[model samples]
Target chain A: MLNELRKIQKKHGYVSEDSIKKLSKKTGIPVSIIYGVTTFYAKLHTKPTGKYIIEICDSPSCYLNGSLDIIKYLERKLDIKSGQTTQDKKFSLFIDSCIGCCDEAPAMLINGKPYTKLTKEKIDKILKKCKS
Target chain B: MQILRKTDQKAYAKAKKLGPKGVVKILKDKGLTGRGGASFPTGLKWEMVLKEKEKEKYIICNADEGEPGTFKDKFILVNNPELVIEGILIAAYTIKATRAYIYLRGEYEYLENKIRNVIKKVKAKTKSKANIELIVGQGAYICGDETAIIASIEGKRGQPRKKPPFPTVHGLYGKPTIINNLETFANVPLAILFDDWDSKLTLFSLSGDVTKPGVYELPVGTNLRKLVELGKPKHKVKAVYFGCFGGCMPYSNINLTNENVCGKDCMLGAHTIIVVDEKHSIVDMATNVAKFYEFESCGKCTPCREGTMRILNILENISLLEARKRDLETLQELAEVVKETSLCGLGQTATQHLLNALKFFRKEFEEKCR
Candidate 1:
């Protein structure tokens, strides 16, 4: 495990990839599987996340609910594309398929939290908060 | 408890002073997310609502915790009404909403009165621009969907529709409406105030394997294995299931902490962990969840309505078959069919457990066949 942790420290600059792999390996999971743990799920991260991880649910539920517009609005405001970190290192905008709150479709996840039934105004408000 | 009965005034005060952006910061720092099934970042959700188009929109709090074996919302209503109120204020302000509604579950009869008292208390004090209303649901789980929920609010049938223009565009009497889950709304204030939802050990309605089954608060990222080992007393845990019957998962797949199996639904889904101890059969868990889907599936979609029933019957009959690779292929095929054609997300994701169980625990399913 220690060896794997050191390997992760050497592999990635943020959120140890090796530790996750070691954990997965210990749990009978593959390294790629561990990546799925982070990649597939928005909450789990493979890298040391930026200050803010702006997540808009792009799942069928959220997308069909208007997350695409929300994403566009965010991209325009942040001047960064989805799955990319902001220049200021303050915000990391990305798309999450689902955070499980479909009842509040058109949802988002900033960091690990979820916001449902989104709008441009609400997105701006959240970005403004992240700016603070 | 009396405090729970009153409107969540403290949340408003915090939002008032915190401002929209500041609230987001606090929420981000506190790691707070909406507790209503989908564990999206509450601060971010508020941010989205705040940064959006300038239209008279609506905010609805979803208190219809009807997924079976889930009741953490009751505690939020009992212990943190003010928090919920504060979340609403922030959400309303962010979304530029003129009004906010708390669509509480009808089964929670006490929630209605308690919420009403809180609204009255807030009304007595300084009122915000947004009007707050406390409404009751007919205890229909389908009503939990945003579209169905909107229809219900408009005095229509509670059935979800095909999304496209989405709710942010057309919702609630043709106006943009944002509906959040009960726990999601409760997390709003905190997310607006704190960045991490794991500031404390949130409550979980754990039952099955161990001893204690009532609602208990466990530290975020706490290993479920440890909880199983020490939650109540070490019992024979055959398999652990996360989420409820609606979202229940099989054991082996149950690992806790950041490991995925550890926490049931810390942020995104139902927090009910049903432990099918060694004594019970995984087939039984599958049966219960399958039965749940069969019953709860909104008939709007044929694949879900029929596929779910078919999956249940197949699994039940698999025990009678020779338990060959063909049965496995059949199970996988049924799962795929259900996954492809479900109208709502619940029906679609319902097969995650069954698929995983059949794939990993093939021996167990085969054992049942004998």
Candidate 2:
């Protein structure tokens, strides 16, 4: 039922307890089990997030190619830490393990679209597009 | 070195002329194997799935290349998606599968539309009965494992199930399923179409401390020294890590061949070759890899869930200079236990990086401890 939760979250921003209860009633799966699954996956969020989710890959390959610099740049540009959403709910930044784009190191997903071989200038452009 | 450059149009025509059984015979003759870590014979897998009496057999193409240092699948998907589709269609026709799903990684969300369009085009052109759907993963590395992938497709937490009922027998909502990796499926068209198909040519993802790090199509037995030459090391190479967190070998020990790389104890998983130069610290590398496992463990069972965390803790302590000499012995013992006791391949091979590090880079661990 993780996919169901994902759909609900996609529609409603987060899988609220009320939606979980409704899903439980609909699928006959217990609310507790549904909640456990939501907490298990990193992609599923209990709280509301920003309009755009920026997930930066911090795995070894990305790290070797300076993924940390991208993370720092995002943190500074957004004025928030990795797990936090901006006050305006414009963006939510996170450090993901690996996004399977190691061929293009220093890669990340800007609202699920990949931006690879990141640079300070490229980050500025991406952030500008998000802000606009 | 240029390996697989152009699609063999002649072979494609030949395979199409030969029908399903004839193509199967050619695959059996070629002895093509799965490109996804396991390296099981592709022909044998197709034959087994074909023999299943179940009517609702499904074909799953694993595009969830989550293993770190592995991007060969992504390359194949981007460059020649049609080839992969042909492979999937060939598999479905051979197995009489009416439904198929490409379990793509969420990071590869951009490729979804393109692949869907290709599937639509192929469906229109071939008029195949199999309905293809793309299932995007939710950023879980464990889902790359076949059983866990099936669980994910079932809308459940991506945890592995017991193996008595393998996917070939019982899979994907309790029906027979044949799940092949993107690379494995991509090779199907080549195997079917070309009379001169060489199964030895495989995609390798090369990265880390190399000047020309990228995906390359090379022979199975290509030597590490030659591959290193292709990449052109930025510094003197100290060691090479094969597969993604699977195994580590000193530069001197690498043969770069599939057989030598994947022997009894070791697995040349995903053909991910990570070169570590002399300036880098093996302890730090091992610690990072252990931390990755600790984070990604599905927590279905105790051995993997708890053991990975303990291994990470021990490695971190050693890196921080808080570990005693006996801590090394404890770490080795723990790795052996985890390797033997874990349920799935992820847990079973999790400690391989650490164990191999301990074996080849003992002095690095000793220096950190001191």
Candidate 3:
């Protein structure tokens, strides 16, 4: 059920109520249960997010490797705080618990593709690619 | 340097020749155990699943290695996925399971394509009867628990069901199921091929403040200091955080064997080590680890959900110098409650690292507290 919602979010940017209702009807699960599942998972977004979602790893290993610095850099560069989508709806940034990339710490996933060993210049280049 | 090569079709054939009971016997003789940190006897688990009379038994390879700092499974998938597929086949054949699923983690989106290709190749080569499928998780750490993983596969919320009807009897859509960790399954083929199973080595995901921080295959019951030495520390190591938030032990207690790391005070849950040098702050590390549990809690029960959040709050207070001395006592007491009352291993062991930090590095917390 969670995977189905994630697929829907992947295609549509967020899980709309109509999709949820349709999913509930198709799967024979209650709408409340669907909502509950969606809300319980961190990756599943209810409302529409931006074109690109930036998930920064903020767990201990990543934190020790200066993931916070990358988050702060992204915030300053993108002019939006963590958990906020851009005013132009181009990017939404948030801190993820851990992406299982501790070896390559200071990692973030831009639209589910990992960017590891991050630097300010690398972040600039990544955002530039997204812009284009 | 390469531990796993091609599918080991010869080993697979030999294992298949040995009937299910014979295979189980070999597994028992080999002393193979679950690499997912529980150290449950693999042979015993397979024997139990094989004995189940259910017609629709299932086998699941738990590739959801989301435990922080553990990526040995990813290494296996990337480099030697065929070995894991073969392991799954052996288990399926032994248990007569008609279906199997590899529950891959969501963070490992990159490895999906490679694993899918390997699965295709292995299926074509072996012509196995079991219908194998890959189920991708949507970012939740609790789903790593076997029951929760089963629930997730059933298209429900990834929360654990209370154990009495364990997965061996009622699992994966209410049929008998067998789930093994990725590394555990990877070891199956090796156990079949090699006779010296007693000396078989296991992979350790080593990282953090080490010169060569990566996966190392070491003998079972290897010492902590020996494993750390493999990584080549960058500085004077003050402590080692063994087994994926398992627990923290000071440098003085470095002489630990794999079998004994989970003593009365700590656990070596997943065999993942994160070295903490002298420069790192213990308070900050504990706070970050607590924050992880708080965020990842499935909220199925109050003790885990509330306890983790409360622990995180107190840790944050301590870090900011706002916590009173009494908060330390409350933190310890809260950890005990969560460990005792939580529904799943996530809650039961969530406070382990925090508790270890408090036990060994109380002065760090004390310095921060008023």
Best by lDDT: 3
lDDT per residue for candidate 1 within B52-139, as digits (tens), equals 5757788888876765445577667777776666667667876678788887654454456778787666555547666888766533
Query: How well is each residue in A1-132 modelled by candidate 2, as lDDT tens digits?
Result: 655776876787677899989999998988898887787677878898899988998777777677878899889999999999999998998888888777678899987888988998999998898889
Model 1's DockQ score? 0.01
Q: Give TM-scores of the second chain, every candidate.
A: 0.83, 0.94, 0.96
Evaluate model 1: give its TM-score. 0.64
Q: Write the per-residue lDDT of candidate 2 for residues B163-266, one digit (tens) a residue.
A: 96889888898998989999888887777666677888888898877878899888877788888789988899998877545688888645666577656245
Span of ten consecutive residues with least summed lDDT in model 3 chain B:
B1-10
Query: Cα RMSD (Å) per model?
Result: 22.9, 2.5, 1.7
lDDT by residue (tens digit), candidate 3, B1-370: 3356454556678788898998898889888889898889999999999999988999999988888888888888888888899889888888888899999888887788888888788777778766788888878888899999998888778889899798999999999999999988888887888665543477778877776778887776677788888889889988877644587888654445554676636666677888888888899889888888998899989999999999999999998899999999999999999989988888988998888888889999999989
True contacts kept of each: 0.00, 0.58, 0.60
What are the lDDT figures for the candidates, one per model? Answer: 0.61, 0.82, 0.84
lDDT at B112 for candidate 1? Answer: 63
lDDT of 1 by residue, A6-65 (tens): 234334534466677567767676666445323322233466646776656553334434
TM per candidate: 0.64, 0.92, 0.96
Question: What lDDT, from 0 to 1, does candidate 2 have?
Answer: 0.82
Which candidate order results from sorting by DockQ in descending order?
Answer: 3, 2, 1
After TM-score superposition, what is the CA distance of residue B315 in candidate 1 from its true location, in Å? 3.3
Residue B120, model 3: Cα distance from true site in angstroms: 1.1
Model 3 chain A weakest 10-residue run by lDDT = A59-68
Predicted complex 2: CAPRI docking category? medium
